[model samples]
Target: MRIALGLSYSGSSYEGWQSQLSGNTVQDQLEKALGKFANLPIRTLCAGRTDAGVHALMQVVHFDTDLQRELPSWVRGTNAFLPRDIAVQWAREVPAQFHCRGSAISRRYAYVLLESPVRPSAETGRVGWVYRPLDGAAMREAATHLIGEHDFSSFRAAQCQAKTPVKTISRIDLSQRAGTGSSYWRFEFEANAFLHHMIRNIMGCLVAIGQGQQQPGWLAEVRDARRRDAAAPTFSPDGLYFLGPVYEDLYGLPTRTAAYDWLP
Candidate 1:
């Protein structure tokens, strides 16, 4: 039987999602717990891999097991052996055709940034920090150029293994919310797929435009350049969150978790 899992994790203590020889990655830990729970070797394939220090609000992964266990047992049993920062949220019996990665139609990510002069202390590793005020309108204008199908070479990482730089960014939305202490900004992205460090790289450019260092048109110029040097430095991954993949309705997976509603 094939099972699909919905999970959320805090990447603060992990070495990203993929299992590594170091045995510190989210995948390695998850697989270990799952193997112990199932009393058999189990391998999982995820919808997407997140970088170090990046959280996931909803991560979908699939694995096959001959051992029969109730959906609730999969969630509770696996989580019992998992770490505090990583967890299995829900489990479902998926059809054999279901693939956590290939079945995904699109992926979404969100970055939560704290625009404050005082650097983050208690929220360290949980939120991205910016000392200066940002021009939201300018950032939005710069973001417009990034939408649609295009070669995102400038924003992709050097180590990215993607075959092509071309990707379709369907939507890029920026919303700001004021607070009693510090203001927050949420940058949401929906795309067919994202290259390694793509969003973080784009965040660097958007931040530059918001800080009035670059014109809104600069993003378009960088996109045309198709060179890594044309873009801003890759931003911090602390605030980045994998909102997870969007699968077809046939899957019937929950679109979000409670963590989604708690974000600013």
Candidate 2:
């Protein structure tokens, strides 16, 4: 049987989503838990792989298994061996043709940022910080240049293995809320697919523009340059969250988790 699972994790404790020799990645821990639960090794394919210190609201993974078990049992059992930061939120049996990564229609990610003179203390690893106040209008204008299909090579990471740098960004939504002494900003991105560190690279430029380091039109110039050096430095992975993938209605998978609302 083919089974799919929805997972959420705080990536601060792991290297990233993919398995590594150190066995310190989220994938390694998850597979170990799964292996312990099933009494056999089970491999999983995820919709997307995040970097170290990145978080996930809902990460979808699928694996083939011969053992028959109730969907709820899979969740409870697998989670029983998983770490406190990683969890299987839900599970379902999927058709053999359903692929966690290939079948995804679009992927979503969100970056939560805290803007204040004082760095984030309580939420240090949970959010990205900017000491200067950000200009919301300038940032929004700069973000408009990123919407629609375009070559995102300027924002693509050097280590990215994506076949093509051209990707379609369906939406870029920016919202802010006032906190006690500072303000919180949430940047949501929806794209057909993302190159490694794409969003973080773009965030660097956006933050630079919002802080008056660059003009809004500079973003257009950077996009047109199609060179990684033309963009700003890659931002922190702490605030980055893999919001999961958008799949067809036939799959019957949950897109959002309760943590989605808790962000920002």
Candidate 3:
């Protein structure tokens, strides 16, 4: 049977979500823990692959396992074997055809920026920090120009492997908040899917706007440019988080409670 697992992790200690040969990865630890808990080989296919130093609040992964374990036990047992950095909040039996990645209708990402003059504290490794004061209102205005479908090549990573540069951005919002006594900014985006480093690149452009390097109308021009070099530099990965995937229909869980609840 197919099983779905909700995951959350701190990206500070690993090389990204995908299992790699060069260094430790979140997928490596997860597969290992699931293997130990199930007493058999198990492989997971995730909703999306996050880059190195990027966090995920509600990443989803599916695996086929024949073990007859209770749903709650699967959650607890798998988490027991996993390290402190990664947690499995819930698990549920899923239909064989329900794929974690392919079935996702949309994905939401949140990028954080510590934009005050003061540097962020040590506790902010996974969050982004900028040394200059940012204009949040200007950033928000710039973000509005990016909404809707467009060829986002200007904001795409040069090394992106996706064959197409076109993508539909459902929404983009830039908001400010009072951080742990400092000013901060949050950049949020929802899309059908994303290209490699897309969020980071968007964040970079927005930061440039906040810093007065780019005008609010520049985003529209970048979208029309359809060239990677036309945009600002790719921002740091520290601020990126894979918030969660949105499914249009129920994924065949036993109960609504069984749906991924790791999101906050």
lDDT of each: 0.94, 0.95, 0.83
List candidate 1 stretches off by more than 4 Å: none
**lDDT tens per residue, model 2, 43-136:** 9999999999999999999999999899999999999999999999999999999999999999999999999889888898999999999999
Candidate 3 residue lDDT tens string, 207-228: 8888899898998888889888
lDDT of candidate 2 vs native?
A: 0.95
Q: Is candidate 1 or candidate 3 better by lDDT?
A: 1
Worst 10 residues of 1 by lDDT: 175-184
Q: Model 2: how large is the Cα RMSD against the reference?
A: 0.7
Q: Candidate 1: lDDT of 45?
A: 96
- Residue 212 displacement (Å), model 1: 0.6
lDDT leaderboard ranking: 2, 1, 3
| Total clashing pairs for each candidate | 0, 0, 0
For model 2, what is the alpha-carbon lDDT of residue 264?
Answer: 80
| The best candidate in terms of lDDT | 2
Q: What is the lDDT of residue 168 in candidate 2?
A: 99
